[model samples]
Target chain A: QKEVEQDPGPLSVPEGAIVSLNCTYSNSAFQYFMWYRQYSRKGPELLMYTYSSGNKEDGRFTAQVDKSSKYISLFIRDSQPSDSATYLCAMGVDSNYQLIWGAGTKLIIKP
Target chain B: DAGVTQSPTHLIKTRGQQVTLRCSPKSGHDTVSWYQQALGQGPQFIFQYYEEEERQRGNFPDRFSGHQFPNYSSELNVNALLLGDSALYLCASSLVGADEQFFGPGTRLTVL
Candidate 1:
């Protein structure tokens, strides 16, 4: 099994809808969790970052990590068509160590 | 205030050819990391360089090697490339011991 697993979803949602993207990791040593958004043919852009098991909120994005369950989530509120992109979850054991990434879920907010 | 920058935004090569991709880190950053992202997949770490030395490496083979210059710019060289080498090569830069790594636009390489 892969160290990190995420559903590669072309999850289609309507404008202004709430979107929830999730990932599950098998490694217990992960302490830093991050969410990145990538558009087609572009590099991944950092969105939300959180440390350990807790929730961190940014403008319209929220990142939550549950170390006990080895799960992480990113919630998007008031989603818009401009929000269409692939959402990737990455985690690292240490701040300076390499990151393990999930396959990413593609999100499409329809107008 | 420029972010990380990579050279030759796109490249095309045949199998068994060698390719070199370059990256210039953001100002004041001293570490550079390379990653490969295939279609429908997340980015995979190749290696990292700091102070002109390789600080860490991932599971990639020896054909994938890199070098770091005193200026903190880096180069990723792939020798004896195969068709599987076709992917988007990314360069990320961060300060030593820092948590946030800024990424470049990436070099898209196609091995035919």
Candidate 2:
């Protein structure tokens, strides 16, 4: 199995809808979890990062990580049409090793 | 300040040819890393350079190589490229020992 697994979603939702994206991992050694958003033809931008198990909130986005279950999620509130993009989950033990990445979930917020 | 910059926004080459991609890190970032993003997939780490040396590498083969100049700008060179090498090449920069990374717009390479 892949170290990190995410549902490759082309999920479509209306503007102002709440959206949830998730990923599950098989490695227990992953200490850092991150969420990145990538627009078409653009680089992946860091959206949220969490050290371990817990929740971190930034404006309309909330990130949750569960070490015990090896699961992580990103929740977007009051989603906007501009929020359309591919969301990728990344994790790593440290900077010494390369980060393992998920397949990414594509989200489309319709107007 | 500019976040991160990559050159030759797109490239097309044939198998058995060589290609070189360039990257300029975010202002004030000293470490540079390279990744390959296949179509419909996440980016895969190739290697990272710090202080002009390769600090770490991923599972990529020896045909993939890189260099970092004293100024922190870096280059990724793929020798004798294969058709499977077609993908988006991404460059990321970060502070030494920092977990957060900033990425460039990436160069799309097509190997026919």
Candidate 3:
């Protein structure tokens, strides 16, 4: 099984709808979790960063990590067309900064 | 302040050819990491450099290598490339021991 698993979704939603993207990992050592947004042909842009097993909120985005369940989630409120992009979840252990990434879920916010 | 920057926005090469991609880290950052993102996939970590030395590496083969200069800029060199080498090569920079990393625009490599 892969270390990290995420649905490669072209999840379509209306503008102003709430969107939820999630990832699951089999590694128990992950202590740092992050969510990144990538526009087509562009590099991944960090959207949220959180330490183990908790929720962190910024502006209209919220990131939650559940170490016990080996799951992480990013919730977007009031999504917009500009929010249409690929959402990736990445995690790292305390030993080194190397990150294991999810396959990413593509989100489309229609107007 | 400028974020991370990479050179040669796009490149095309034949199989077995060598390619070199460059990156300049953000100001005051001392560590640089490289990743490869294939179509429809997340970025895969290749390796990371700090203090002009290789600090860590992922599962990539030896044909993939990198170097970091004293100025904190870095270069990724792929030798004996195969068609699978074609992907978006990304450069990310961060302060040593920091959890957050800033990424460059990336070099899109196509091996035909």
Q: Which ten residues in a row have the lowest lDDT in candidate 3 chain B?
A: B94-103
Which pairs of residues clash in candidate 1, taking residues 3 or more apart in a chain or in different chains? none
* All DockQ scores: 0.78, 0.74, 0.66
Model 3 agreement with the true structure over B1-112: per-residue lDDT tens digits: 9999999999999999999999999999999999999999989999999999999899999999999999999999999999999999999999987778999989999999
Cα TM-score per model: 0.99, 0.98, 0.98
Candidate 2 lDDT by residue in tens digits, B14-94: 999999999999999999999999999999999999999999999999999999999999999999999999999999999
Better of 2 and 3 by lDDT: 2
- A30-101 per-residue lDDT for model 2 (tens digits): 999999999999999999888868899999999999899989999999999999999999999994458889
Q: Which docking band does candidate 2 fall into?
A: medium
Candidate 1 is graded, for docking, as: medium
Interface CA RMSD, all predictions? 0.8, 1.4, 1.7
- Model 2, residue A39: what's the lDDT? 97
Off by over 4 Å in 3: none
lDDT on C-alpha atoms for all candidate structures = 0.94, 0.95, 0.94
lDDT per residue as tens, model 3, A7-70: 9999999999999999999998788898999999889999989886789899999999989999
* Per-prediction backbone clash count: 0, 0, 0
RMSD of each: 0.7, 0.9, 1.0
CA error at residue B41 for candidate 3, angstroms: 0.6
